[model samples]
Target: MEFNNNIPIYIQVIEKIKQEIVTGKLKPGEKMPSSRDYGNNLGINFNTVARVYKEMEMEELLFTRRGLGTFVTESEDRIGQLRYEMAKKQIENFIFNMKQIGYTKKDMIKFIETENYLEGDE
Candidate 1:
C-alpha cells in the first residue's frame, strides 16, 4: 500500500485495513497479516503497523488472542455500519465543499451520477 505523505503513517495503515474490510478483501473473523508480516509487505516499520492494529482494536474493529494473532471482528454488520458512517461523513464533506464552490444540489447529484457511471465503465 502506498502511504500518503499528508497523513500520519498510522492513519494510512488504518485506512488500508479498513478498505480491505469494506471491500471484502478481509472478511469478518479472518486473520489479518501480523505486524511484522505487514511491515515487511509494505516496507514500513513493524511498530507502525502494530500501532495501527492497536488503534483498531480499541475501535473494536479487531480482536486479538494471546497466541492466535489478531483477527477481524466477528461482527460483519457492525463493520458495515462503521463503513457506512464513514462514507456518509465523507459525502457530507464533499457536499459542503461543493456548495462552497457554488455547486447546486442538482449539479452535485448529476456529477455524482456521471462519476458513478464512469466508475462502472472501469
Candidate 2:
C-alpha cells in the first residue's frame, strides 16, 4: 500500500481496495477495514481512505451498513467490468498517444507483440 507521489492519494487508495476485491482478498459482501484501520495500515490519513470509500460507494462497488462497516458489494462482476473498462480506456489513450507520435499501424502491432511477450514473461 505504498502511496505514489505522482497520483492522487485517494485514487491510489481506491485502486488498492479495488485490487483487493478483484483478487479475492476481499470477497463479495466482506467487510472492509474501517477508514481508521485502513489509514493506519497504509500510513495514510483517515480522510483519504474515507474519500476512497465514498468514491467506491458512488461507483456501487461498496456499501456501508449503518454502524456495521463498509462492505464489498455482492456484484463482483460489476467490479470486474469496471476494471476492464478502465484498462481499455487506458490502452486506448496509449494508442492515441502513439498515433500522435507518428507510430504506424505496423509499429503499433510490433509494440503490442513485444508487450505481450514481456507480459507473458512476467
- Expressed as tens digits, the lDDT of each residue in 1-122 for candidate 1 is 77789999999888888888888888999998899999999999999989988999999998999899999989978898878978998989999999999999999989988778567565
What is candidate 2's lDDT per residue for 5-99, written digit by digit as tens?
89999998888777777778888999999999999998989998899999999999999999899999999588788778778888899889999
TM-score of every model?
0.85, 0.79
Off by over 4 Å in 1: 110-122
Segments of candidate 2 deviating more than 4 angstroms: 114-122
Q: How does model 1 fare in lDDT?
A: 0.89
User: What RMSD does each model have against the real structure?
Assistant: 2.8, 2.9
- Full-model lDDT for every candidate: 0.89, 0.88
Worst 10 residues of 1 by lDDT: 113-122
lDDT of 2 at 53: 91
